[model samples]
Each structure stands twice: as structure tokens, then as C-alpha cells.
Target: MPLDTGQVDTGQVDIGQVDIGPLDTGPADLDLEEGNGVLNRDPLQSHASIGEALRAVRQDRGLTLDELAERTRVRRSYLEALEAMRLDALPSRPFTIGYIRAYALALGLDPEAAVERFKADEPVLDEPLRAPIGVPDERDPRVAAFIAGAVVIVVAIVLWNVAQRAMNASAPPPPKASEAQAWKLLAETRSGPVTLGPPLPAPVESTIPPLYETPGLAEAGPDGKGNDSAPANINDLSDAPLLDLTTLPATFTPKGKVYDSGNPQLGSLVTLQALNNAALIIRGTSGSVYFARQLAAGEAYKVPQLPGLTIDVSEPSDFQVFVAGQSKGVLPARQVLASKLAG
Candidate 1:
């Protein structure tokens, strides 16, 4: 080998045979994670039920019931029902779907997919929806008849009152004093300058008698010495105030059923009118933040319907809530209040 270094040997070197696998140019058959469509395990399919799927997703995200409730404005009870697959406990189909859609979106899942899964789990009713009782249909003949009767009765009462007024006007003329006497009285009264009574002097405190002191009976003994008979203070027996609970104003509760205006876009429109300056945070049921700011006095904010439609304010007493043109009453400052709207 040392001798061959000086000269170039014209010889072909033998290379050993080797096998090569085909190049992996195509997409790799990689397995994805549970939520990432991985390993042929659809997170949706792996679960025994839709509720299980939802619960898994929620748990995987480390969301608690209270946390989700605060986030979504959906009640904690309702969330529990959803996780438990208590279909009967949820609201109507439309409302339930709304809740599910919002929840799915919050969990970063496909809302449509969640909805479809939920629909499969819950059975739709074949029977038509039942209307609420006591609400009369406007097309009912009885309603029209009642209205007509009321109008007729009101008209009759008005006509009777009018006839009585006409009769009284035609028949009445009181006996008059002589025109000369009337003129004389008017002339005498009108000719004089008006005179006002002298102003009364304010009472002196020393001159005022004691509450129990009688005009004639003195507290002094027969010898004109002071008698210890009178109490230091005479407490009025009649003036003794008795607490009357009945005098308190009756509690106010909104009357009549609330009919949905059928505005799906706005479940419940609430407006806040600040009576004094306040800081507040408004959140949807899903706990989505809608507003957070210091609102000045007399400022008004109309908030869209959100989950739970909740508000947390620094000074609740400084503001009032209005819904559908009705006052909900003053808010308790520094407290969180949820919407009291009917389902």
C-alpha cells in the first residue's frame, strides 16, 4: 500500500449490494389526539353517549360546573342536566339547542356537530306543541263578543250621564237676590283697600306650660310648696306609637305572564340607567364579557340578551334595570344579579 501511493492504479473498486425501501413522499399516517381527530378514535364516537362526549370535552378543558355556569349564563342546574343527559330537565328543543350551541362554541368544538349529536340523543315529539292555558286566542268569537259588550256598556253609561246632565241644566235656576243688593255688595267690597290680620307673635319657650300641667291644678302642695306628684316627663298614652306592620307598602311582584317577543337574536333586552356613577361588568351566561367600564350618572346602556344575562356592578344602588319598558328595580351595588326572566 505504501508503494502504490506514488502511481495511479487503473482498477474499478467493488461496492457491496444494498436494498432501499420506497421513499415516503406521501402524507404520513399520523395518529391525532383525542380532540384532534387522531388514532381513528373520533372523540365524538369514543364516548358512550353525546352527554359523555360533552362531559369529556369539558373535563379535558378543565372546566368546572360553576366556571361554565359563570361563563355561559346558563344555570348550574341546567349544565348539570346537560352533562347528565337529563333531556327532560332542559328547556324546549329550540332553547336547548341554543344552550348547546353556545356551550360547544365555548369549548372550541364544532357547534353543528354537537347539535347533531344532541339531536340524536334526544327524541323529538310527534305531537304538536301545546299552547299555554288562559291565553285567549284573538280569533275567538267569544273574545270579540266580550269586547263588544264592554263597549256597549261603556256607551250606555256615558249616555245616561249625559242625559242626566242635560236634565239638570234645563231645570235648574236658583232664586236670585235683587240685582241692586248684589251690585251694592260688590261695589262696597271692591271699593275698599284689602286689609290683612296682624301677624301672631311667636310663642316664648318659658311661657309654654309643661305637657302634663293643667290650667287650674298646680303641682304645688296645699302649702304652696312643690309637690312631687308629677312625673319628670309625662309620656302620652295616646301618642305612644304602636308599630303597625300593615302600614308598610305591599311587596311588588310583576303580574301577568311574559310572552316571548320571538326575537331569537335578543332573548331578553335589558337596559341599565345609572342614577349615579358606577363601575360594572356585564357577562353572558357562558361568562362571556360584554361590557366592563365606569358608567357615569344618567348614562344608559342597552345590553344584548346573553346567557344568564348577568351583571356585576361596583355600586348597584346607583343604577336601575329596565326590561321591555318595565323597571326591574334598583340593583344592589357591589353585587352580582342574574336575569329573572322566565324560560
Candidate 2:
């Protein structure tokens, strides 16, 4: 039913027809345009970065990082890392993703959307390749056997060294040999005596008359008398001719200041005596060095009667050679080659 009211003049009132009908209950009209609708809001577009969005949402919810950590069961440091976008400060990718999801859930946000935003904001890193860790199989008997063998070998080596040291420590040292014994030993080890050439010719006798047999010397006396049985004047003997040393026997006398290699001999005992301190080397033709040392003054070395042996002296003038105890005099040169001394 409709009720019609007649016009009534009032300052701010006007009468009108009123119709009573069913009550209208419906949704209020809303502007559903591109940027004006609540359902069409872009969550990521509200902040400059994912970290800023997370911080803004947490701040809007009146929640501190400590409260968020308690709600999400994460450390406050990790929550601060997320809000600060310090991905390196957080854990690994998967663990960080879990932390982000938990944080978003505590802030009443979409966990998956937050994780996606976190992933988008995260920079790609070229992580180094790591070798996969292998778990050893303890059931293999060969491995245990190898380990035992290595241990046994190490222990055996240690014990062997210790035993060697102990034996060396307890063992008596060898007795020292005298110088004469050492020479005897050296002589015994050398080669046998060499065969020498034929013996040298006997010395020629001088035809000159003897000094005592001189005619005037035999008859003259101390009284200047021609007596047959008196001592002669000592001055009268000076008139006799001097004996020629060149005519002496080759056996007992020295050859000269130079050795005659023409007739090399391995005498009964050929010795080398140092007139002064000097170095000496006695080497054989076979390249065998029998003696090499500094010979003190007056020190002697018995030559090994070996054929084809040569002598070397640091100073030829400081050495003397002897054959059968008679000095033959100094060497001809510093080096007496095999042809010089052993021919």
C-alpha cells in the first residue's frame, strides 16, 4: 500500500508518497577497477625490495625480530639477516628458505609467496663443486688387515733400529794395531817381489900406484933422512894424486845426485828417506797408490819391491833415495815416472 501526503509548507520539510515493500539486503557496490580493488592488490609492489616488504609487514604487525624468532623458533640473528637481506649471513639455500617460510608464517604472510620473493631477490652464486663424502665399509676384513700389517711393519722397524743400537752399544771395539804391525799387514797384502835384471858389473880397479907405495914417501923419514922404516912427512903425501871416486864399486857407494834409471834394481831393502819435511806418493804402473802422505824429516818408507813403480815428491831436493842402506842421493825431478825409476 502507498500513502499519499498532501503538500505541507515548512522551512525544510516536504511531504511525499511512501510505499512499504520487502526489505532489500544486498552487498554494497565497490569500485572493481585495475588499481582500486583490494582483491587486486600486488603484495610485492608495496615495497622496493623483498627485505623491505618483509620489514614493513613485520613493523605493521607490531612484531620485533625477537618476538618473530620466538614465534618461528629461529634465532633472532637469522630473522635480522632476513629483514636486512643479508643472504650470506643466513644459512644455506634450503635452510634459508625454511627460515624465510617460517618468518613469513609468523608474520601472517603467504609462506610460499615469501619464499618465491626471497628466491627472486637472491643472487645466483657459482658454488664450488664438492666431492661427495664416502662412508667407509667397516665390514671389509682386508682394510683391517692392511692397517694391522702397516702397524706391525712400523713397530718392527722401530724394534730393529733399537736392537741395532743396543748391539752396537754393547759390542767391544777392535784392538788398535801398532805402526810396525800396520806396515807388516800392508806388505803382506801387496803383490810378490818383482824379478830384477842381472846384477851390475864389478867395479874396475885403478892402475895408479898407492900413496904409501910412492918411492920418496916410502924412503923418507921424519928426520928428512932416506930411511926405509920411518914415518914420512905428512906434507909429502899431499903430492900424491887424488883417488878417482868414479872408479869406486857400484855396491857400497852412491851413484850420484841423480839416479841412473838405466839399471833399475829392487834391492834387498830400498828405502826413501825425507831430507826435509815433504809430501810423497808411491804409485805402481797398474795405477795403484801404495803410499801417499807427508813424510816428516828423517822419516823413512821401505819401498814395496814391486816392479814398474814410480815415486812422486812435493820437493825433489828434500828427499833422498837409498838402495840396500846406501844413499843414492836426491831424485832427478819432482816426478820420477815409471820409465825413470822402474825401468
Candidate 3:
């Protein structure tokens, strides 16, 4: 301390402006002042750029990220990114530098030294961010598969919905059992002209009272209880089996021939066998006898042995008599009048 003799005391020296031993300016004291100045320097401190620092002095201490985190309370990820030099992964430039300062302090180094060193070499970046690293191009396989799967699922759902709507929209009201025959005909007509047998214009699923036999048969009730009774009207008599096509006079009219076999191998002449139940007896010109017996509705008939004189089966109403491959006329059951067999 600087002292004047007039103001000096022996035990405690006093001075008007005495030097307290040159203001306590030892190395330790000077270091303390310098450290305090660094701590309070500036609010907006500068930071280094990415990859600017080739090496870190604090890292030489051999402290691990976990070890340093224990000391500074910074997260392990931040400490790792800092040491890894993965600057882009960090929060911000100022924050990264600040973290580095704390890390240096935790490592028993001067915190300001780390900051100053980083500030000296600013990192330089030349490009803006676009695609991420390790990602594929526009036609990547994984991306395409994902998109395709999504599209397929969407289409399947749409098709299912369409099918459900169609089924619901086309639903018809239920009908009485008595009207089933008429309704069935109408329904079949929607598909196309239904042929019971080829050459027969209409398929006869319903019992067809023959054109001539219609005048000879009786009109039974809806249940057909009186089908055997005598003719109730002129039309009823036409249903009786009064004539075979062979017994008819040549003056009567007939139409149609087998235009095509539909199958060339079978040709136009198709023969069906009479089962235990048959319709009529067919005797060929070659002395072959075939029994055509109780004919069922929609049932077919064929001469088993007559390969060339086969019967082209159709609805009874569709039966046209083709003699020697020429059509005489269509056979309306019970009305057997032979006209020209050539159509």
C-alpha cells in the first residue's frame, strides 16, 4: 500500500489514496479480472461455420459424451453431434457454440478459449437444402409399390359397390305361382328368341295344344282336371291327334327345312332316342322300327339306328317336316296336311 508518514499508523497503514500494494495486481488477480471480462463480454457472440474447426483441443481430454453430459447437464445427443462435428444436426449456430463453451468449461479448459478459436474459422456452406441424403429418385421401387397397392384397393372397392347397386336396382317384385309360366316366358324373351328345338320358332315348355287338335280338345280349368273331356269349343277339337303328316293331302300348306346342321358332323339330321317313355312310332324306309312313345314336355326324340334320317328336335311347335332334306311344312301337332316340303 502507498503511505504518507503524516497519515501512517504502525498497526494498520492508512493513506489518502494509498496503493494497496499496486492494487493487488498479482497473476491470479489479473487472471480473475480477465475471466470476469470474458464472462460479461457481449450478448451477440460470434460462432464458427460448419467444418471450420479441423480439430478440437477440448476433445483431447479423453472425455466421453456421457462423461461430459454428467458434468455440463447437456443432452448426450447434443454432445455427440458436437463432437461428431455433425453441425447440421445441432439446434443452431449460436447454441452450438454456446454448448461447446459449456463443454470446454466442463473439461477444465477456458470456455472463452473454445469460443474464440471457433470464431476465428467460420464455416462456409454453398448449397440450399433440397432432397434428403440416402433417398431415391422419382421412380423408386418402394414408392411405386405403395402407390400401386393403394390404387388397386380403391378400384376393388368401387367394383364391389357397383355390383351391389346393380343387384339392388334390378330386383323385381315377387309374383304369384299361377303367373309363373307367363312371367317365365317374358323373362326368357329378354335373352333372345328361345328355340325349343332348332327350326321351331318358339320353345314349347308349356304344353302346346296342336294347331289342329286345338279344335278337338276341351279347355280344362287352371288345374287341367278335365283334359280328357270332349271338345268344349271349336278350338278344343284342334288339339286331338287327327292326322299324321304322311296322311295329309298335298294341298295343305307346310314350311321350313333344316337350313344347317348347326353342326356339320351331325349334319342337319339330328336323331334323339325314345326312352322308356316315348311320343310316336317312327319306322324308317329301311325296315327299322323305332317306337316314339309318351313324349314329355321339352323332351327330344331320335331314331337310334337311322343315322341319315335323324330327327332335328325342337319344341313341338317348332317341328317342321323335312322329307328328303326338303321341308314340306311345319308340323302343328294333330294338323297333318302335307304341302310342298321344299322351303
Candidate 4:
């Protein structure tokens, strides 16, 4: 071989150094171990059930159900149900499908394919449609009876009201009040003087004395006349004056210009007469408008003597106030509170 080195082509070969270009620095191809080395089976091979396929992949990856549960964050019991294909033991279909997807991902298998296989194995049950039951048009006898009773009660109430009205209509009117009673009522309503009846005669003083003061009975008078201050007959009241009805002053001078009329029904008729053209507004204390108008000369408006009523006059002097037929001269003020005039 040493003698042939000189005869061989030196240009094509190197004696001590050879150029093989840069060595391949990329990662070398690695032959991954398919299954548990002993069986050398494909973990992702097609199986009759998704559960079997998942179980095989799990075993190939050397993972127990407890480990797979930890990896997938699924319950061990649920994983067991999935591996055993116990659809009843698993959760709802959607939840079971989620578990399957998680299990496939943990075992390095396709999640969608696993889900498809799970669906094919356990088809979802369709609920049978039910026909609606018909309701009868006939009403309950108890309800009808209740309605009839209600109607009867309403009719009875109406009839009772009619009968009460009829009874009231047939009843006689109340008796009229006597003159004395009328006077008493007027006195109660008005602050004015009321003449009840004519004045009675004065009482007569007896000139006789009591029988106990007789000279023979007990003590004697200076003239020896027995109690001349006492009446001769105790029962003789003929000399006594008649009992006077309750008396009142002959006249009532009101603090204000207005005075109450003796008649209660008519009240105090307050007449507002326009001496000249004037604008006036008659209202209540609560601001309810009773009258608002421009009066012509000599026009008159009878103001109701209702309490709390008031009058506003544009020209106080133009309007003349008359209460209970007595003239009060003119409007007391531009805005007159009628209650101030009430006696």
C-alpha cells in the first residue's frame, strides 16, 4: 500500500486531510417509541369505540386514570365512565363531549375526532312530541252557582235601595218649627238682639208678715201686726208678676259695619251697588272666584254672606256696600275680607 501511494492520483485524495464540506449540524432524525415498547402497537389506531381508543392512548402514554384526571382536570370517576363507555354514569351529553375532548388532548389524540366517535357511539335521544289536551267549553257547576249567587246579591241590594227610597218618599214631611222655636234658632245663629215676647208686669210686694211672727204665735211687730210683709194666703200668687221669657238687649251694635239679619235662611243679604262704572272681583278666602265683571253705572250684585268670602274692587268709592238692607257707605277697602264684616 505504501508503494502504490505514489502511483495513485494524489489530487483526488488527501494523505492526512480530506474535505467532506461542513458537517450536518441540524438535529438527527429520531425514531420515537410508538407504544409501551413490549407490544409495539399504534396508540392512535382506529377502534370500535372512542373510549377504547382513548384508553389505548392513555396506556401508551403510561398514564393512569388518576394521572389523566389530574392532567385533564376531569374527575377520575368521569374518566372511568368514559373509558368503560358507561353513558348513564357520565354527565349530560355536552359535558361528556367536553370531557372526551379534554381526555383526547391529554392523551395526544385529536379532540374533534374523539368527539365525533363519542357522538357516533352514543346518539342523543330525541324527546317525543306530545299532543296538547283539549279544554272543555262547559263551565263548572260550582263556578256557575257562585256567579248566580253574586248576581242575586247585586239584584237584592238594588231592590233594597229602591224599597228604602220608596219608604222615604211615602213618609210625611217634618212639622214646621214654631215661632218661638224659630226665634230661638235665630238667636243661636246671630249675634244680634232678638225680641222673644212682650214684657211682663212687675211683681207686687205683700204688706203682710209671716204667721210665725204673729203676736200670739211667737214674736210681735212694733204695731202688734203679725208679719204684715207676708201674703195672707200662701197659695195666692195672683199678685205675682208673670214669668218673663229669656230677655235680650233691644239693640246690638256690631263692631264692624255689617250686621246679621234675623232671618236664618235669608242670612245677611250684602248688596254691592255700583254708583259709577267699576270693575270688581268677588272671591273666597281660599281664592275661588265667585264673580268677576265690569259693572255698569247703577248695576247691583247681591253678594252671598258665605263665611270666608272676600271682595276686590278697582274703585272702592264707586261701589256702595249694603248689608242686611242698611247702607254701609262704600267698600271698606280695596280688598275687603268679608269675614271682618261678619257680626
Best by TM-score: 1
lDDT, candidate 3, at 11: 89
> Runs in model 1 with CA error above 4 Å?
1-40, 131-343
Instruction: Name the candidate that leads on lDDT.
Output: 4
Could you give candidate 4's per-residue lDDT for residues 1-343 as a string of tens digits? 4555456554754243322323343222333343322222233334557788788777867889999899999999999988889977876678999999999888777788778767777787797854444656676789989999999999999999999999999999999989999999888889767779888888768878765643474455333465656533322223322322133112222322332223467555677777678888878778988788888766676676787787788876676666665665566556766655444
Models ranked on TM-score: 1, 2, 4, 3
Candidate 1 differs from the real structure by a C-alpha RMSD in angstroms, to one decimal, of 42.8
Please give, for residues 27-73, the per-residue lDDT of candidate 2 as tens digits.
22233544334222344435656678888888877988888888899
TM-score (C-alpha) between model 3 and the true structure: 0.24
lDDT of 1: 0.65
RMSD of 3: 24.5
- 1-343 per-residue lDDT for model 3 (tens digits): 9775696556864323422332222122212232233222211122233222212433445656677788888898887777667867887678988887887677665677667656655454576866666676667689889999999999999999999999988999686667878898888879776557557466668897856755423566333665554433322324433345564333323221112323335322322222223244444446454443455433333223223232222333444344443434344342222221111
lDDT of 3 at 19: 20
Candidate 3, residue 242: the lDDT equals 38
Q: Ranking under lDDT, best-scoring first? A: 4, 2, 1, 3
Candidate 1: minimum summed lDDT over ten consecutive residues — where?
A: 232-241
Choose 1 or 3, whichever is better by TM-score.
1
Point out where model 4 deviates above 4 Å. Answer: 1-45, 129-343
* Cα misplacement distance, residue 110 of candidate 1 (Å): 0.7
